[model samples]
Target chain A: MTGSAAAALQVEGLWKSFGPLDVLQGIDLEVAEHEVIALIGASGSGKSTLLRCINLLETIDEGRIFIEGEEITAKGVNVDRIRRRVGIVFQSFNLFPHMRVIDNVTLGPRKVLKRPASDAEADAMRLLERFGLAEKAGQLPDRLSGGQQQRVAIVRALAMQPDLLLLDEVTSALDPELVAEVLNVIRELAAGGMTMLIATHEMGFARDIANRVCFLDAGRILEQGPPAQIFAEPREARTRQFLTRIIEAGRL
Target chain B: MTAQGGPDATSRGGPASLPGSRAQRRRDERTSALRSTLVAFLSTFVVFGVLVYIVVNSPGWPAVQASFFAPDIFWSSLPGIVAAFLVNIQLFLISEVLILALALVLAVARSSTAPVLFPVRLMATVYVDIFRALPGVLVIYILGFGIPGLNLPGVPTDPFLYAIVALTLIYSAYVSEVYRAGIASIHPSQTAAARSLGLSQPQALRYVVLPQAIRRVVPPLLNDFIGLQKDTVLVSYIGVVEIFRQSQIVEAGTFNFTPYLATALVFLVVTIPLARFTDWLVARQARRGGGASGAASQVASALGRSRGGQAAP
Candidate 1:
């Protein structure tokens, strides 16, 4: 908001590598307020790494990142403060297995946001209720079904009241029948105008929720456009080939 | 263990099978189990009986029995040995508490990834290496004698103090390795999930990593405590007059080695139960599939609903 011309999130010329392999090469992206961007790619196509680097969970080899127009990658920037505005739900549903569902949801707000326990719990309960996970609040994550666990993870991210949320294949690990339940939670968030950048293999879900879809191939966004354009008439051969594979696999 | 599962699986799979065959199978299993039990008992009895017979028939048997198995000397020495064991208990108790606190600090220091904490990590690594490389008694001797030998002002010359300090230093090195392994066993994603939620490294460790790590290492930690308990006798070398020293005193006074046997009995009484307890905990942890927190929290959740309330509309 401070920089009127800036998007809600921005990355310019992002480059990241792991020892001998480059994961992201010369990447640029901008996510406007309340816009949903779905990143579609193969397994090693850098989607999760991109999300991690943006959250500062992984160090970037060369890049500049901004959240709400503040240069997060600037020297001496407080990565914690930057991460506070960005919430991420992982594929594995990394809820603290040791804590109860309510505690898992409330931990961030209570510890990092400095909210009182009662205040944090109250908000967490509301989020759980909204996600239809209220009854399971007292249980540990392992007791819940995969769909339920992923939903709880989403609620945990939402508890921070983040300005932006990144979901890295959030439903990839769930049973096929359970995927819809988690996708529905994302649908509701999208309907409510929550800004999200999702990395997904869920082609149908991605097309349904994303305003814009970007197909990444070999660590680069080979093509990106409105969902209609990208899904129906991708201009790139690699995007077409990927979509054909998904269709042949009956995933789309 | 797998054989136990096999019968149940077969029984469930073919309910229409002949009742005669089923009865035959059960009888066969019972007979096999009985046969194995009898063989185990007979083998152990024969092995130990021959060993005892050799010892009792040896040329030095009478002298050894008079010196080592004198009933009167054992009974007379029993009271003193039991009393001196109290000192060992006290040393172990005090040293265990200090070791827990100090080892946790070392583990956290060595687990740190921050550039600012590099020196702390280095020092912890060095401390663990140095203490673990040297023999425990050497540490006890050097500290118990060397430090007091300095005769520095206000320094307590008590060997008890040095005994405890040396025990803590040596045991903490090993215990910290257990803690470090526990910390490392936790998958990296757990920390990432916490850090992604905006928690700082220290906060993530305190709330997420350490709680689970400490719980996972409880059995190992208690195993080390048992070792520390037995090692308390090593302080006898430093003139602390604990169990071993007391037994030595009784032996010299009475000219019999039976007091040494009595000392051994006292340690067996104290430490065997503890060793068994550690084994039970390890087995229980394995049965629960390494999620020790799951069973306790599940019980807690079932007992009370502290977080339970009406869901918001």
Candidate 2:
């Protein structure tokens, strides 16, 4: 579903603050169409906040976010329109617990897109199948495993056919064994040319899948470069210390 | 001391010589038997008390027996009974339908953060509080008699219509609280997920929040419906010829209270099934792990097992 050869998202001079706490300070990032970018940061470093801002889930204090050249931060812009083209998967899976997996996946398409039930069902089934959740089509979210639910959440977003996908620690809520399954589905999505911006702590998945990696700290982009440069040789002392602590904690 | 030592020695000699121990054992057994007998007797007494109360307090038992074969009184009261039944059903059904619709709107309006919604929120709060605080009798009386000067053109300000309107208004307030609680019980993440899927606020609420909220509120809603059913009797005060009112008229004419007993039986017959259905719904929700009781535990266990399995390898 790759469209024109243009940037899928461009976030420039994004400034956001929650009261006195500066969550994002003049951050800039870009992702080409079909490119995957990993945003890595410690908790409270504003990675998730940045992702939320891109999808307009969180209103930025200042800055402009554009998806497919449509400025999302413009006054009087229909946020719902922008959100339609940008899918987001939360860290908590956040599947509608009352709905069946199939229903959860097709809700947006059927309700927002106003598609027929049968057509939405078919598309939902296809997406569920892609995520290895076809068998769980009739199961409620709470009945599914955390990984299965997260994968279903992904399919739920994918059924919207977004131009850009924002993943805010999508696999963080899953069990370690299940995390790999969700990440594997995401890897497949990236390989299939889905444009993705992921905020994650899974360094191996980031290293393997991300075309570019950015390190964020205290609401600022500490560094941005290729994964090899960011992971293999760090130039900043803060980056080295952060990597050392993460490595010592056995999370890397 | 010698004698006591002798007895202790004898008791310690063998199990056969354990006099105090045997006696103590017999006493313990007798006490337990007495306790069991007392409990059984108390339960039987309670049951007998209820049956006796029914038999003694029930009016015109002999009259009912004498007229049992005649069917005259029963036949005479049939029309009133049928009318009351129909009105009761209409009142309940209309009130329930209106309550459900209004409750959902009120719930959404109350939950919204828009500045314009503030007045709506206040209005909903005031409506709920006022109706909930007022007795049903007062509400029916006010609607039936107090609103005399105001009448819609060509529409009769009849007691029946007044009763229906009053009941709908009162029940809608109570039902809205149920809806609000159900909607609030849902995790905020669900709304976030819907929004992230690009659903407009209305789309998300209609497709996502409302369905879940309605499902959770089903048992409570059923309870409210039963309450509404019973509250139909209050309309009798306004001369609507409901079951209670019909019974009163029959009693006045016949100088016999059999009709009142019959009315009570009718109420029992109608409300018992509704109560049982509510119970069944509650149990169904419980088994589905959707109710308040074990839902958290079940979710916790599921999450724990999944985490354990993942951690294993």
Residues B113-148, model 2: lDDT tens digits:
778789998988888899999988899998888775
Worst 10 residues of 2 chain B by lDDT: B304-313
Q: What is the C-alpha lDDT of each candidate?
A: 0.89, 0.81
Q: What CA RMSD would candidate 1 show?
A: 4.6
Colliding residue pairs in candidate 2: none
Output DockQ, candidate 1: 0.56
> Chain B alone, model 2: TM-score?
0.71
- Show model 2 residue runs off by greater than 4 Å: A1-6, B1-83, B116-122, B148-153, B254-258, B291-313
Reference-based lDDT, residue B12, model 2: 36
lDDT of 1: 0.89
Comparing only chain A of model 2 with the true chain A, what is the TM-score? 0.97
